[model samples]
Target chain A: MMRVAEGSYAIADAVRCCSPDVVSVYPITPQTHIVEHLSQFVANGELDCEYINVDSEFSSLSSLIGASAAGARTYTSTTSQGLALMFEVLYNASGMRLPIVMTTVNRALSAPLSIWNDQQDSFGVRDSGWIQLYAENVQEVMDLTPQLYRISEDPEILTPSMVCMDGYILTHVYEPVEFLDPELVKEILPPFSPVNVLDPEDPKTFGAFADPSWFTEFRYLQYKAQERALDLIGKVDKQFEETFGRGYGGLIDTYRTDDAEILLVSLGSIVGTIKDAVDELRKEGIKVGLVKIRSYRPFPVETLKEALKDASVVAVIEKDVSVGYQSALLTDIKGALYNTSIRVPISGFAAGLGGRDVAMKQIRKIVENASRVKDEGLELETEFEIFDVNPECL
Target chain B: MQESLFAPGHRACAGCGMPIVIKLVLDAAGPNTIVASSTGCLEVTSTPFPESSWKVPWIHSLFENPASVASGIEIAFKKFGRTDINLLVIAGDGSTFDIGIGSISGMFDRGHNITYICYDNEAYMNTGVQRSGSTPIYASTTTTPIGTQSPGNLVRKKDMPAIAVAHGASYVATASIAYPVDLRRKVKRSLEIKGPAYIQINAPCITGWSYADGDTIEQAKLVVETCICPLYEYVDGELVGVKKVRNKRPVEDYLKTQGRYKHLFRAEGGDVYIANIQAIADRNAEKFGLLD
Candidate 1:
């Protein structure tokens, strides 16, 4: 990331520095560059590891699961359809407590074949036993990614880790990133020593049937492991700051929200653009700020309630939907506000799908609508719904 | 030597063939082996609340990750930070030969130190006798019910042992509850092997197959004896061995033993049933040299 570093390239460098022993990847648009760069590194003997170019996303994850069980530090990357294909594997990796690090270039799932920046794809895997981290800029992509191995591989948090960045926005854009030295990275992350490994020297068995008798208890264990992961995110963040010089704001990053009456809440790279708009609004004496979400899984309910406690109005801008219900991330934020004395009205806005541009101008308009709603005591259910699809090409 | 890993006394029906297979398999695996089970009848009926049916240290994960769980358990032993446990996974047809296919294949392709055993009764008997991929051709289950024109399942049974071998598994074999001694012997061999080894057992079901409780063991033997299903093994991803199919009879004998294939021979076009069974046996023999 020393030169004209694209966001995806920075992520690729972080993955290589993390020194994942096995990388199982399947390519999909906008997200492919991160994997492609990593693959090239492996091919050029730049990364000393097993790089599996899988037949499909399913195989990609399957390969990682195998490698993880073999006690190899594994990595994988995907987006949208690719993520959907690895849906079952996500559960398998977490259930088995394999600390696999994956990069998800967030994109929309297809019905009519959309490939755009959205929270839906990453949000879809919210319940799986994995520590989820969202990166808002190329620097975060470079910085937070290697942190995944530290957090995920922690014995107390032996869970899969996902570093999600906006599909095309952060993945395609070039930004100056200060690449951490490999020696420093090695000192920071340390080697992965597995609790379990599949080896022939000592015979073992896996993937047996758990009849109705004892299935619940094991599921409870998976659930508990995820809970353990939430705490480790902060613990790892602290150690990261000590070595790397910058700390990730646990769960959510707050911007100028000290006396703000209106707050823009979102995740992924959109937060960068929204932060700019928040600055612009502040210049005009507007009491507006931005909250960039980091972790989505083990969604920071208590932490978020504390962060947004004083805000008068909160606007949720999402790229994914719950269909007849709320947008995916908005629902979690609302649940965090539940039973709290802070009665900040929240509005949900769905925008950007099918590779469509989520321009700063569009985000500025959404922020404006949100600021206008703050004037009244009302919260709109649907505002800034800008993802209306045009007719398909002939 | 495994001292019958499953403790005696669990309700697996009056003539539950699986527990017996489990007992023999565990005996073959010997005292050092560990078992991971899936969510199914064997796991549910044996290890009910507050108690377990196992004498050995056993665990039950979800239906899908038993192989993966076993993979973990296997690696744990390899790391043996201090344990000498041998990992063994016992699943029903629904879980092993089907739902757990990916993890199983992964373990095999990676050559993990684990053994996967599928106690196949040809259906998802635990879930009320539904059709699974391993359900034999012309088998009758809730999902593959007998109809006016069709007998039952039209698709051929999946050759899971062969699939395991093709994945470069160290060893793969088919076993039957009818032959406890041989089944135990195979288990012992699989346990001793260095990489992923798979064993498929034709454990009959009294309720699912609509057979008399007494006939469970009888049908399991008849299955292989009739050549409808032959016991065999694939070594090093190649068809290197076969079990004895002595005095092979018509597929009808195996079919008529259970109600699953009752519709096959009873239907008007049932005459075509022999050709299908013959085709299966023919392919099995040709594929691995099982019969003359």
Candidate 2:
């Protein structure tokens, strides 16, 4: 059915279709409406589950951990400080191998306390061992959420998953989205039966103390599970496409990058604007392209290499800076291209931080900057340039 | 087969009072129960690797979220369509009175039907007897040591049961391992309530209190008899069971048995600290009507 809906409501509807047995949440901006709609669904008898209005983000994640351990499908949502408060239990949920799914609405961290869109909050904890997937629009947010439960609950990869969408950019925007039939979702995602749970009839101890002799082995298993997710992601996406007839480009998507001299790389809603800029630049016969990455954690190294292998110069644009070094995604790209012989000058631009608008003009400025670096044989003055930085006296 | 959900042959200090409280709680909760514990002496001592002292399902994660964890299990079972499984959370006093207070208070306010038991040993016994919120005033601890110019701790014990009641818990009670029947009855009664229930047991630490191995129960009994730790239960914001003291003992009788309070008797101007301690006990007796 083609219907207009906000991205948060679309995710809420998708979550309802998955029949999560428990939904625990504490309201945070940009993520509030997702849980609010679910609460209404539970209240109006549209959904049959336990809806808990936990006191804080800490308790929300903690309660989900318990519920997930007791063999119930669980869901939650948060952004910025809410996600920061849940930082400790995020590792606990994954290390215990509970198949809990969460929606992380991307927002900037606080000191100045700006309730704005940025990728710093999620990127800061990229090493926390969650399968992180970024969504570009309302349709992608609706379509990609249901596949998370199936991917997370696979016995080979019993890890938690985070479906991150840009805060207000994606969550508050309305778009025409086609929701899959509830019956189809039921057929695709089977009932959740965990391999290990807290059952009194068959008692077992979870979160036991692992001493020096065995602690590393447990971490090794967690590492192995993440390693397995790379393949599992492809299989799940293929099965989803086969059943639903719509497939997101499995790991990374490309637009007109087959024979381009310059390429732009980014993720989330910013990719849409960058793609438009790429098209406008290409009309003038400039050999430029765009590669939008969807999955950042199980990073698609081979896919990135294949897409940008022929480009003369590559530019990475992101909303977060790593303070003393380049942006996180740019550092990751450098690492991925380390051993490969595809040596092209890759420059990074930091834009749209703290909810500042990343207009098409700024994106064009980024493209021109990359073009100047390529044409004049110039090295990047800094690791990455802060786009639209204010001058001293201006 | 003996019917104890918390099994035996685990590691704990000799005359440690926590296992007695655990056994009483499990006996009252029966076999159809799940236990969620926090990081503390009981957890570290009970479930160390390949051997477990738990015959029931047990989980121990971080130190400050057992109540939140139990809330998860309780709701999960509710969704699973099985309401017969009793969920119990057990944590030490440090977890209950200090680091975990926010999580536990949230659990109580949300009105989940779970029992949270805090074994109050008055200090962080597992971490070498450091001071905690539940540590009594002027008691010697590793963190609040006795010096020439300084007595032990400068604050009074945090009134956790009162805090629980303030959160509108369906049931709140203070029990001691000194009286098994009273403790068991409170646990059973608390499990009957339909919302969050809290039972704080004053389980004196043998090593931390610097008491003889055989005097755990005697010390616990003295605490109640002297009105230092009154035994009482509250049901739905009403006081129901306030144990009366037939012959009230002085605070010195309870204070002299432990080394934590030994500093008061040995140090100069220590009589002032003892008078303050006596006043606190008198206040407890008056507030709870223990003299009646």
lDDT of 1 by residue, A1-394 (tens): 2667887888898888888777767678988898899989988989887665545677676556655766778788889898888787788778767788888888888787777777788888887777888888888877887788888888877888888888878889986788877887887788998766554445333334455766788788777777776777777778778888888787788999889888888887778778888888789898888887888886877788887898878888877887777678777888789888988878877777555666777767766677677775454434435444465732
Tens-place lDDT digits, model 2, residues B74-166: 999998888888889999999999998989989998899999999999999999999999999999999999998789999999989999999
Best by lDDT: 2
Report, in order, each candidate's fnat.
0.03, 0.72
Clashes of each: 31, 0
Q: How many residue pairs of model 2 clash at the backbone?
A: 0
- Model 2, docking class: medium
Complex DockQ, candidate 2: 0.77
Docking model 1 quality class: incorrect
Compared with the true structure, all predictions reach lDDT values of 0.77, 0.89
